[model samples]
Target: MRRTITKFGSLAAVSMFALALAQPAQAVQAAGATGTTAASSSAFFEFTDGTDTFVFKLTDSAKIQQARNILSGVETENVGVMGKVVKTPAWYNSPWKYQIAPNSVSFFGMAMEVCDASISYVDTHLNEVGGALLPGSTWCPWQSKLTREVTAP
Candidate 1:
């Protein structure tokens, strides 16, 4: 009787261990080829000046890196407008041109949105300011307007 009981207990323990080992493999098989990949995220920003609207989509890491590189060199320039020279500061230049305001980064998965303030030079005399140019006076110093973040789908 004692021998029989010992054999039964050993068999039970072995069966439990085998069952535990089989579960993970079964799960992996159920997941299949599509289930093993990781999720992707993206980031972007939108701007409106009560007239026109602009949206920037940062969908890739390269784009994010490029934006960061562009923000590092911020400066001003003088451009000709209707035969007249005008001093205009270029926002989003090399450095500090892309101003990431404090506490503006919002994360959604691997993506994040960072509040930023940027500007571009324009020739007002020609009535042709390239792109969606926002005047410096429109945004308040304390108010946060820019959104830079990653998004996921």
Candidate 2:
């Protein structure tokens, strides 16, 4: 009788331990099924055109910082004229001025390209004159761009 009682007590203790370990996993699974596994957020912004908009979805704060850095010129490419064949700077890699809003970010800048005498001439002669060819100057039309950040709801 004594041995039997001891065996039963051991089994009960093991069962309780197993139950305790399983509880957290069950709770996690339940939360995942309900789509509440993690916190989510999003941001949105519009271009200078005002009609165009962009959105970004971020899973963590690191992504938000990356977007900020990109806009802040931390990783901006140099201002240069685009060239044919070699494929001068297009839209994405160009330097842009970014603005952070309550729920979004806005980016605006001009894209430089090596055009025929028409575009370059207007830029150099009329716009530049003696001064340097400043980027996004009167010679360069507003590229008009925007970007936004988003995350799971």
User: Residue by residue across 37-150, what tens digits does model 1's lDDT show?
Assistant: 111334444433333332334434544544444334321121100111113322322221232221222221121112112233222321332223323222222222233332
lDDT value, candidate 1, whole model: 0.34
Q: What is the C-alpha RMSD of each candidate to the true structure, in Å?
A: 20.0, 19.0
> CA shift at 54, candidate 2, in angstroms?
34
lDDT against the true structure, per candidate, is 0.34, 0.38
User: Pick by lDDT: which candidate is best?
Assistant: 2
TM-score of each: 0.25, 0.26
Model 2's alpha-carbon lDDT is: 0.38
Q: Which candidate tops TM-score?
A: 2
Prediction 1 TM-score vs. true = 0.25
